[model samples]
Target chain A: MKLKAPECVFSSAGFCPGCGHGLASRLVGETAEELNIVEKLVTVVDVACCSFNIDYWNFDTIMAAHGRDIPTAVGVKHVRPGCPVLAYMGDGAAYSIGMAETIHAALRNDPVTVIVINNSVFGMTGGQMAPTTLPGERTATSPKGKDPARYGTLSGVELLKGMDIAYLARAELVGVGGMAKAKRYIKKALEHQLNGDGFSLVELLSPCPTNLNLPPVKAKQFVHEEMTKYFPLGEFIDKGGDK
Target chain B: MSKVKLNIARCKGCGYCVDECPKQAISFTGRISEKGYDTIQVDDEKCIACGSCYRVCPDSVFEILV
Candidate 1:
């Protein structure tokens, strides 16, 4: 019998060497496998890097429009009921353009699993500034650092906390241990959805060295400074009460 | 002891392993990978094989064989 590998593009078990999204995606994938959601699940991916790995992912997957992932996923759950649905998207797509769909999904208690890759920058699109980009932090568009007075506020984890979310957790994909821990949280989120509790999201603060114009190690440090300052860490809500 | 190995030819230089390493051992030589971008390299003695690199890599460059 030939053994198949875990799904996703960076199949070598190595990340982008500098990108943090790989760890976040794999954590979700591995957690999905460990929790036995692979066969019964279909992922709805967006235009970010994960879009490329949709083909390589070891599960049924679908591509949603840039900002339409949540509604597409919620629709999937409404039709199938038992199938596990995931709306995996980048920070810009999720917190910015896709905010309305995400809010309504949670408001209606949609059971689709959502994982937002909050790497601060619109990593896939030339690192343009994103709503989640911390105030006064630099990006391609915000090269001089984000200006709160000019750009408005930046917050995702807090925004989710305001909704009737079931299981909302935020973790950093900084290092090996942190990455593994983050994966475990993703597994738990899927478990919650499998139980039909409601909206579940894992806000992952990851590194983007290329966009940050920093080395990988230094990128990790930037994640510590920039990502954590806004995203924070740990479980923000558990309406299910058990987990 | 077992360790992880990387393939430079197939590497797309996504940098998933660089920050995924528990010991913080992975790095780039600043030379372009076959697919472009500086490539990822790991220090064998430093990797603990928590499989973090394997878990998050979009490029799939890690090989953990004993």
Candidate 2:
């Protein structure tokens, strides 16, 4: 068994050390390869850390305006219905600034796959407190740590649940088990697109070591231990799967 | 026996793979990579090709050949 890097993954990425965007993009590439949709893949990335996927993945990519990736992907799908369009964004883009677009896409059940990298902070910019920022989590903006009463957290999966989407799930990238589960969820989301099912979204709990001010190892542990407690893992909704 | 290869130049020394390796087969080589971070090496004798390192590496550093 020789595990080779995905062919769709080209030159090195620009993410900071221990950033989970690299791994998340690699999983997308691998999923595209397995589904044999590389040539037909059009990724619309948000103007955040996730924009790095435009370089990491060897696919037709569009760097959309901040927090507009979902609608941008919807537009691409409208013109190129055959292409498997993916909206790649971070929690800040998907849950914060792009909240309306994100919700309406699921409400309309648009045929696009949205992968949100939830790192709990505004990664590319300074480490500001994002919508997904855990209560008591320290960020640049929340120097004293996020206050639950003052600033509550938002869970993408929770907001999108009960919608008529094709699939919905959340997974992390902490250990081998988590990564494996994330790949499975991602592959399923892409499969739903090929099947022409409505919208699909997979929120990946990733580590922002630079923003969290933790070392790589500790960041991984933080997501595995602390983040999962708030945003539990597993498929929240699988319309196509057996109930 | 199995082997894990490294793309030494692209490494950022995040040490995710080093910590994820269940066999404890990988370690920092003390030599700096082109990225100016300590590069890691694998002990082939201790490696079991579990692919944990390959799965956890953010930079795609390891390729496991069994």
How many times do residue backbones clash in model 1?
Answer: 28
Can you tell me which runs of candidate 1 are displaced by over 4 Å?
A1-17, A241-243, B5-33, B36-58
Model 1 lDDT per residue over A200-220, tens place: 988888887878888776888
State each model's CA lDDT, in order.
0.74, 0.90
Candidate 1 RMSD computed on C-alpha atoms after optimal superposition onto the true structure: 3.8
Who wins the TM-score comparison? Answer: 2
* lDDT of candidate 2 over A1-243, digit per residue (tens): 688789899867888888899899889988999989999999999997888777788999999999998999999999999899999999989989999999999999999999999998999899999889999999999999999999888888998887889999999988899999999999999988888888999999999999899998999999999999999999988776532
How well does model 2 score by local distance difference test?
A: 0.90
TM-score, chain A only, candidate 1, equals 0.91
**Which stretches of candidate 2 lie above 4 Å from their native place?**
A241-243
Q: What is the per-residue lDDT of model 1 for residues B1-66, given as tens digits with 9 covering 90 to 100?
A: 547666567566656566556688788788886666677777777766666666556455665654
The CAPRI-style docking tier of model 2 reads high
